[model samples]
Target: MTEVRGVVATGKGKPVEVTTIHVPDPGPGEAVVRVQACGVCHTDLHYREGGISDEYPFLLGHEVAGVVDAVGEGVQDVAAGDFVVLNWRAVCGSCRACRRGRPQYCFDTRNATQPMTLPDGTPLSPALGIGGFAEKTLVHAGQCTKVDPAARPAVVGLLGCGVMAGIGAAVNTGGAGPGDSVAVIGCGGVGNGSIAGAHLAGVRKIIAVDTDPAKLDWARRFGATHTVNATDHDTVQAVRELTDGNGADLVIDAVGVPQTYTQAFYARDLAGTVVLVGVPSPDMRLELPLLDVFARGGALKSSWYGDCLPERDFPMLTELHHQGRLPLEEFVTEEIPLDDVEGAFEKMQAGAVLRSVVAF
Candidate 1:
């Protein structure tokens, strides 16, 4: 067993603890990663607040950039010293989705067979099956996707979740393309990422809607051609006005609330798509007119991890960042140590920063 320090959520609605844990040696089909940096995602905060489930002590943190330290007997795709980005999706090829040639909608994903534990041998539930907020983590070999070694760990790691999910909501799920007019509601990390993705795809007009003026200004920095302060304007009306009195070709509800979802639904042109990428609480419900749902004449979809295939996206997006096409650096607001995760979560709640990455 290899000893490492990691963050843990000991109970529901409790503060996270940074404690020592034992990570077992890589078993068959597993790899040990020396975590370089992990992003302080809202999901980690959710796990701490008991929003995810009752699994405790839950090992928190998931968005990770690391280097391979060891690999098990069956691992060949990645090896020691290889820099990689950790992902939760380790597609099982035999799943029905894979057999149908749509591995992106993979039904069966992988995790380590052996468990990392507390010093006394109590098993711990690694957050999102990754538990990247540590010096080292054990994962299935397929979870590691080798990306360009030149990319900065702090910035690139965000792509492992929020950023990729936003981009995928636009490009993949929404089918946003050149000549498309796109409107994104909620200009947070994910929403800004959608704006950037729309710009990268050559969308002619990109409209950003948010209640906070600061977030709207930040959205403009990424690629929003038009900004609508939702506090002072009707979101749907603003979006339609920005799209020349009709509506956008693609509307993304990155906020995931009922009001924002309704705005996204009505803010689209005829046959335009609406992509819901924001996470909603289990109790949340959407009450829409059944006739409107049928008359909308377009797709209403949800993007999971932005429908991303890490093996294909990480390397390509890294290259885009290197070429100065994608403004990835804009996402890193600060870099904090592992212990500052609690403080980071506070800031995340306040919307004071886009991301506060933990650098190991």
Candidate 2:
């Protein structure tokens, strides 16, 4: 076992603390990662606030990149010293989705069988099966996707989650192509990533909608051709106006709220796709007119992890970043030590950053 200092959320609505945790040696099909960087994501905050489950003493922070430090017996795909990005979906090849050749929707993903625990032997629940807030973390070998070693850890690590979600939402789930018109609601990191992905896919018109002016400005930097402040105007109307009095070919709701989703539903052209990438609370409900659903004549899809296959997508995205085509560096708003996680969460809650990465 390895003794590592990690941030732990002891209970709901309480601040996390730096404590010593024991990361056991990798078991069969598992590997140990010496984390180089991990991004502060909203999911971590959700876990800390008990939005995920009742599991306490949660080890949070999932978006990560690192070097493989060790591998257990039967692990052949990756070895020690290999640079990798951690992924939550460690697909089980025999699952129904995998059998159908859609491993991205693998119903039975792999995770570490051995638990990382506190010094007192209390078991720690890893966030998204990857608690990377520590110096090191243990995960299934399948969860480690090899990437270009030259890429900056802080920037590339963002691909492990939100950034990937946004990009894949456009290119993978939405099937955006050349000359398509796209509109993204919620101009946060994920939304801007969708805009960037659309641009890369050769979309002709990209409209960004958000209540925050700062985020809208950031969206423009990410490839938004037009910006609409949702707080100042009707989002659906604005999107329609930007697309020549017709709605966009694709409308993405990155905010996940009922209102934003409704806006996205109404902001798409006939037969256009509506992709919901934002996560919603359990209490939130949607009540659209039943007749309208049939009348829309389009797909209403929900993107999980942007429908990405990490093994296929991660390397390509890293190459794009390296080629200066993806602008992955722009998503990183700040970098801080692991100790600053609490403060980073504060900034995230206040909408002050796109991403605050933790550098080890």
Best by lDDT: 2
lDDT of 1 by residue, 1-360 (tens): 899999999998788899999999999999999999999988888889888888789898899999999999989999999999999888898999999998899999999999999999989999889999999999999999999999999988888888888888888888888899999999989999999899999999999999888899889998999999988999888888888889999999998889899989999998889999999988899999999999889888989888988999989999999999999999899999999998999999999998899998
Candidate 1 clash figure, as a count: 0
The runs of at least 3 residues in candidate 2 whose Cα sits more than 4 Å from the true structure, single-residue gaps closed, are none
Give lDDT for model 2: 0.95
lDDT of 2 by residue, 51-128 (tens): 899899999999999999999999999999999999998899999999999988999999999999998899999999
Reference-based TM-score, model 1: 0.99
TM-score of each: 0.99, 0.99
Model 1: colliding residue pairs: none
Per model, how many backbone clashes are there? Answer: 0, 0
For model 2, where is the 10-residue window of minimal lDDT?
A: 237-246
